[model samples]
Target: MMPDRSDLSAIAALLREVAGSIVMPRFGHIGPADLRTKSGPLDPVTVADEAAERALTEGLRALFPDVAVIGEESVAADPALLGAVAGPAPVFVIDPIDGTQNYAAGLPLFGLMIALVEGNQTIAGLIHDPLRDDTMLATRGAGAFLLRGAAARAEFLPLRVAAPAPLAQMIASVSWQYMAADEKSRVLARLDAIGQTPNLRCAAATYRAMASGHMHATVSRRTLPWDHAAGTLIVEEAGGHVRRPDGEAWRPADIDGGLIAAADRDTWHRLRDALYG
Candidate 1:
């Protein structure tokens, strides 16, 4: 069943609860033993990531007992868990902490991301900032909003992407870390055509900045569902455009082929042409 506004609020409260009880307490206290590498030295997972994932998994299951939960750390331990996104049942894709590298270093630039996907479509998405105690959320047909404060006394502000601009006048976050050397070289050579291109090393932050009109676009080489699913929906709901550089819609199960998110379809096309054309 599609979650209504009340259900969304409940989920937001759960996110806040997990952030307060499990995530924030362990933030700056992470030690050498509390951290370990995942895919490589650049990809690290900490105690907070694992603990928060467990708590969120349990909490989400309690809310919807039969729904599937696919978390980043959980999938790392068991690759088969990612198949649930393509299954018939709705699945919650969780990135307990999106910016693990920054979070492990005690930088307050990380976020908690969760997306509810039914088949190939994302129904609801949420990106929560543990340090700020606020959430950016979107339900399929409903518009995106910034949620703050307690559930009983929460505030919701509509979110919109920035107006489209010329390629040389836009600010974007371009992530080419996982790209092929040839493709990376081509992208790097073309970046001079844009106004500013910075990599936040955090998809949640990148998406948040774009949705809040602080950024114009973002190009990513990795398409992990937990990383892009929530942010994709949030950006699209906020009047932005998210798709593959080839101009295809982003599916929950798509793990490669690169993705581009921009303020509008025109901006997306322009950016794609400028960078990949």
Candidate 2:
């Protein structure tokens, strides 16, 4: 059964309102607020991120009791919880804050990304940019759209990628970490060899650029399902393709592998080959 657009719109609006209230109050507060380093010093999580995730989880669970939820902050506390939910049940995966670094730095480049995942497929998804008051949403066949206002009036916009361009002429979005030093050097060398400029904007904005035709492609060695699931559907719906560099299909279950996404089939294939070469 298809999810209702009105319900999704309502959820988006609710998320925007809640997140805006939480984030807006801390815009320029400089003092440290009980930061914790998860994987490393570079991977920091703040009280605001956790508070926001809690708000979303509670609201979703209250609003839709049947659906399961897997949030990044919750999984961070209990990594084993994800395996327990690995079944056919529809799970709502969420990254309460995609660009944690940006958020910590008080930059407005972060967002709240959520997706409804059943098995290996994403059914419905929304990425809400509270700073810009823009919500990018998509359901399986309902098409993608941008909702920007209090009334939540739908502005239908077909997502389309530009024609396949050469890797040299493309602006690639690649992350700096997640790969070994040698592997990172090799990837950077190849990117430089192709004359492609590498930009490491947070995943939300980076994928948003890919969907909006502002960037050609994005490759990541770190596969956080919560981060990729929502954006993956958005990019594919926008006429792009995402897969492992070896040409294998990607799923939310495999969150420890690599991904290669492009504006089109030609670009996807070419980038995959270049990355593996």
Best model number under TM-score: 1
User: Model 2 — TM-score against the truth?
Assistant: 0.93
Give residue 208's lDDT in candidate 2 (0 to 100): 80
- Residue pairs that clash (backbone atoms under 3 angstroms), model 2: none
Q: How far is candidate 2 from the true structure (C-alpha RMSD, Å)?
A: 1.8
Task: Please write out the lDDT profile of model 1 over residues 181-209, one tens digit for every residue.
Answer: 99999999999999999888899999999
Q: Report how far off residue 272 is in candidate 2 (Å).
A: 1.5
TM-score against truth, every candidate: 0.98, 0.93
Query: Using alpha carbons, what is the TM-score of model 1?
Result: 0.98
Candidate 2 C-alpha error for residue 135, in Å: 0.7
lDDT agreement with native, every candidate: 0.92, 0.78
State the lDDT at 154 in candidate 1: 94
